[model samples]
Target: MVSLTERTRQGWLPLFVLAVGMSMIIIDATIVNVAVPAILADLRLSATDVEWINSIYSLMFAALLIPLGRTGDVRGRRRMFVLGLVVFLAASALAAASVSGPMLIGARVIQGVGAAMVVPMTLATINAVYTGSRRVIAFAVWGSVIGGMAAVGPLLGGWLVTDHGWRWAFWVNLPIGLLVLAGATRVPETRDPSAGGHDVPGVLLSTVGTSSLVFSLIESQRYGWGGSSPVPYAFALAVLALTGLVLVERSRARRGRPVMLDLSLFSISSFRYGGAAATVVALGEFGMILVLPLFLQTAIGFTAFQTGLIIASLAAGAFLSGGIVPRLAKLMPARRIVQLGLLCEAAGAAAIGLVVSPGLGPWTFVPWLALYGLGVGFASAQLTSVMLAQVPSRQSGQASGLQSTMRQVGAAIGVAALGGVLVTGLGGAMERHLPDRPDLARAVRDSAGAAIAGIREPATRAAAVEASAEATRRVSLVTGAVLLAGVGAALLLPDTGGRRREEE
Candidate 1:
């Protein structure tokens, strides 16, 4: 067995390029979140429309990731990677230039398509390119970059939105994209010699099924829950599609044809457990990304930039942990390390619940958030390394795709479920306290979400809005508690910690 060491000068550059492109994608994911209000104001969009703008990108990306990952394995990881970057760059430009809400959203869907292509292939490429200690380092660095950018995206967006306007935030990607494109051209191609061509039916089933499931979850918040028409019907269709997808994959596996996601991949205990852990971890992390900034800006009355600064603590913690986890992977058993990571996350969340108060300054969020990030960093790096480590080299793409899909699915569901909790909790709290006053109640109900931005009654709006803010703060604290519980679940993951095997 040959080792895929990262000693070559040429190899490092492309990996760095891969990191940059990934940063662009992750940054864009959260960057638009903080500036959503600015987008809503500029485009005169509705809440549903805004949700689509966000959901479309994730839906398409998550839906297509598996198929694209398989395509990268069969065709060429490098080819798919560059192609994805091109599409993403083009879509970013289109998104930036949009004249209307729908146009921008259409562009975002395309951006999601492109992101779907890029993100999975990047991981496949890394798996192909590095081995041994170097492979561990590469994943650690990649994890840090991802965590760092996610943490900083809001601050970056806030500054860009506040200083140069929101368009500049998307525009910022253009130059970076072009540079990565150029750099990517110089990298060595990673091709799996035994990999087969694209699995068309598998692609259709997986993409359709994933999109349906995501759409159903996103719509659940809007519809009043009783009807079998939209929500129930959509969910039913999603289940059927996913069931059919499983059948299709099984058929392919039986016939000896490669499928987009190989069910056999999950037979590896380490891979299965690690992948599941990764999915849950993503749910907690990405969901927090959606909620935390809103908490800071809406509840604590922090400016976007100030909120960004506080969120930066998350990245700092991740950065600090990213560097430390790989060495820890070398030190402790994998299960113990994962357990420790989970404990750290729980502690961090509990700290946030205890310390995060409306009257507390932005600086107060820093330590708790950093602690959370540290746990996130440890789990993230080890999780990816462990999951991919168990996969056969030929099927690495499938493993990467499956893990990425799970992560994104977790993210989508997390935002929908947890965001729902925050919104509904706040609304219920407001209704309970202020429902007797019709005008004030109407104003509270009209606020659209946990944010009181749309409320109109000036005389009573202030007090009512304050109540809403407090409610949202309480909800956030609850969310933190729930997330901590999730961290506790990480204790059951398999012990796979050690030096990377020379054969892997």
Candidate 2:
């Protein structure tokens, strides 16, 4: 038998490679927000086009996850992971070279397809290969990469946007993707020989369902519900598609045939409850991510680079928390730890909400942001462990893909719902402050909170800034409330003891 010492040496290199591969996809999701203004100007994008750029990546990513994960299971995971990197790198080049909004948005959609292929393979590799305390550590690192890199993207995006221009933001992926390609050799290949044939119907139904749902949520910000837009119809189609998907999968499973997602997984209490918590947590966390930088740049008038620096506190806190959480894992169940982490997030965000003002120092947000980061670190890291604890290694890809889909769907909804809240609140506050100028109010809302600083008159700018602060305050409070809901979901989880099945 291989000794523990030998296993450690063999695992660490591939683990490093996989984590970085995973990081690229997660960071891409939020990195563009800080660069959106530059993109809008460079491409002369319409408002609808801007929403497509921001939302299409997530929509495609969420839609294809289950099918791709199942494909990886049937074919070979490491092969798919490598192929995905190639696709993503090529798309990055296309994105960087784009001269128009539609071209760039099309590149993002392709990037999402590649991302969906890579993400599940990374997590499934870890779940299959690692065991004992090493698995715990591997999960902590995986989770930390996810939680930390998301916040880190804005900082990197801010710097890149401020200096090299927005295209460089996509251009920057070239070297990193190449490095990951080189390191791909170290990652072990895994697949389920017994996973059986593909369920073609399940694939189509799930893809259409997830795509429609996410698309509708995305459109909610621009068109609102129940009006002349496609939002209502898209949402209805999503429901019908998803329901058909469930029926088809259950029927196939009952006959001992192939299925994309095994409905039986939900029978595992940890998977069900833990997944619920993850969804809610992502809903809150990503909204905060999308809004905070806008508030910093527009109301406080900080440069994107400066805004990124201030926001880095969240990343710092998350990384710092990663350092301690493995030890904490030894002492408590993963569920309890997740609950505590969400509580911390709720507290920190609510506190930040109370303190928004034009004159508020950038550094003032640091402590609260740090606390929120710590919360993200703990919750994100442990939730992976908790959710996958009872899952068979053969199905790890499916579980990982499903959980990741929930988080993406939650993120899409969060961006839509919270974005809508910001617009509505900003419009009302603007109306109260400048009732005679609806056009100015429309401009501020349309910019995604970017236009407030551009107001020329001192008094008009002051009113605009205050309106932004109030709207930001509302977003923060809503974020806190959503995290608190996650805490409730986490509380329902069955505790899988830390270091479960560990050696040493």
Candidate 3:
């Protein structure tokens, strides 16, 4: 066994490397948001297709999260992390070089697969390496990476897309991936030594369930909700698969083979509530990544750099949260801090909804965005810490993986669901205004509410802009309200009181 002191000394290095490695995933998801317009022009993609560019990645990443997490437990998390990096790097290269839309989306799916592998393993490794107070501190650090990468992704993407090219967004990951791979060596491989073999049945059922569920959600947008699509059927199938998965997992557990996930973990109220809250919060946060930049550049006319900077302010809030949450975790109940954080998000979203003035510069959003970040920082960081705290050492890897899977699933669903709201709303409005002018109407439609907002006729343009602004405002408010529901979830969560929830 690695001595505690020796492990402590070497552990954080790997954690840092893991943090950096996982950042590529977060950054890639957000960075591509602002660049979609550029990508469309370069690759001649439709609006629906462009949305897929973002959705596909999150979809795959979310779908594979649980299975990958389980695999990390049976295999070696360090080994998985390394493999993920290599795959991601290769995918990034392909994405950077892709000359067509299909090829690009395919590459992004590959990248997502790699991300799914890396994200959970990193968290699992952290759980394996640290213990006690140090573990709390480590999670705070880990939480920072989550917020930090997301916060900065837009900024870096803006710079890369605006200055060099959109391809640079993926290209940059190559060097970062290499650096992480090199740094990973210093950190020892950590796995559940007794975690027998892989649970293939559980993996299959979960994958089928998650993939079908996500596919159904995404499919609903293009086809009308009623009969235009088979999304409902897909969703039904997914639910059935999940039911099947539960039965299989129970049988596996009864048979004494290690199940991919211990169902009993859900019996811990803290973990269940924390995981739910994390999922909802993730939906709001990642959903915004897809929605907000489009509002900024397309509707507000801000440059990509400006959009990035504005988004970075939100990151600044997240960074602020990261720094303080660990200390906050010490004094107050994490549940309370989490509630406070959710409220912050709600308030920020409300402010953004009520006060997005057209001529107003990016600074107009500073306070609210920062506040939103603060909410995410406080609530989100604690969720991870509290969730993992419930599980024993042997199950940490699985728990960590579950948390990651939930987060990614939330993100993917958010991107698709919330994004659908924007697209559908915008399309409806444009059709109402451009009756008889099908070509112009279609162009307006193709721009996805943005084209209508760009109308140059002063009266028409102002009206369209205001309408577009209202759409964005509504999205902000609705998403914020969704976050507030998470606050309520936090309230129901078992209070650890004083120190860790695990102790109580």
Candidate 4:
């Protein structure tokens, strides 16, 4: 058998290929945000409809992560990665050609399924191919790509939407996906040698549970929690599904069968707390990202290209921090570093919230955005390493899947929760400003972009823009509060000196 030592000498090419593949999915997660307004306008979608378009991707991705991760471990990581790319490529093309809102969202759901398969294989393959200090470096590069690609997605999407059309945002994935597929040929096949049969029950439970939870949250704002609304019913169903999932997994464990997720992993404090911190970070980061573009385009009158450039400042900070994190880890405890990062994120969010105004230009946001990105870089660069440190190499696939699941769950819920805040705030603001015009207020509440388009009076348009800005500001403050909670979660992580420790 070829040792991992010989494999590390294969150099960084494999990691690069994996990063490219990883970036395609991560970028897709947020790339649609920059194009959301355009899609809504083109397809005549309501705000709730647009939210589903952005959210179903994350929802589907989160639901299938564990099952697919288990599949890779039972089958072959390389095989699954290649297969995922093909599905992703097909879905991207379908999404690009979509002429209606439902068609585009259905394509996104398929894309998310492919993403679930691709994401875990990258980290699991990296774990299989590298060891010791080399593994640490590999993870840093992996983390950097995750942070950088997510930050840059909006920028790339903005340019595509500005220069071409919203459809190009999906079409541009074709060449990149093909290139990644070609590069994947070099990656060695890997899997858990002792892996057993699939856990069909666990898969079904997790998928239904998570999807139901996300759907309930996303639709709650549209359909009131009371009266004839289905929100409470959906919430009850989610609770039942998730509770049943826990019972089924516990039963499977007693029988010594393969489990979709090794629930025992949560017993380790680093894994448990690290997953929590990562989830909170993702929630705030993705939620704010979803809202900022709408505020920029609808409230501040920036073009898509201009909005992308402004958002790029966040990526710039993340890239610089990601590059330096490895060196920083050599000097300080990873836990303290993560704490500092969360503090920075919280501070930046607060600053942006306080300074936000309808009259302010994009340039006013650059510094705060960069600060937030720098914090994200520092936190993301180390959290995965921290979480996976206690797991043995054989279980990397499961651990990676769990981490990705948490992040996606956070993202799905963030879009729903923070988006609800934005929508509710807009409604309240409009009502206070225009109490006599209930019909007009309801229209504005449905879609800010559409409302701005319909209002012919300059004074009314200006007031609507102001309301949107205030709503954005309120959401920013909420995001800052969420980051502060993440700081608390980071505090629970053990102060390991950036080194992996064996499970006791």
Error of 3 at 417 (Å): 1.0
Instruction: Please report the TM-score between candidate 1 and the true structure.
Output: 0.91
TM-score of each: 0.91, 0.94, 0.93, 0.97
User: By TM-score, how accurate is candidate 2?
Assistant: 0.94
Model 1, 327: alpha-carbon shift in Å?
4.1
Let me know the TM-score candidate 3 reaches against the reference structure: 0.93
Any runs in candidate 2 off by more than 4 Å, and if so which? 1-9, 44-49, 145-152, 499-504
lDDT values, one for every candidate: 0.73, 0.82, 0.78, 0.85
> Which of the predicted structures, 1 or 3, would earn the higher lDDT when compared with the native?
3
- The lDDT of model 3 is 0.78
Residue pairs with clashing backbones, model 2: none
- In terms of lDDT, the best-performing candidate is 4
Please write out the lDDT profile of model 4 over residues 179-240, one tens digit for every residue: 99999877878888877788888888888888888888888878888999988888888899
**What are the runs in model 3 whose C-alpha is more than 4 Å off?**
1-5, 432-442, 450-460, 497-504
TM-score: which is higher, 1 or 3? Answer: 3
Best by TM-score: 4
Give lDDT for model 1: 0.73
Q: What RMSD does model 3 have?
A: 2.4
Candidate 1 residue runs with Cα over 4 Å from true position: 1-11, 354-357, 437-451, 454-459, 474-478, 481-489, 499-504
lDDT of 2: 0.82
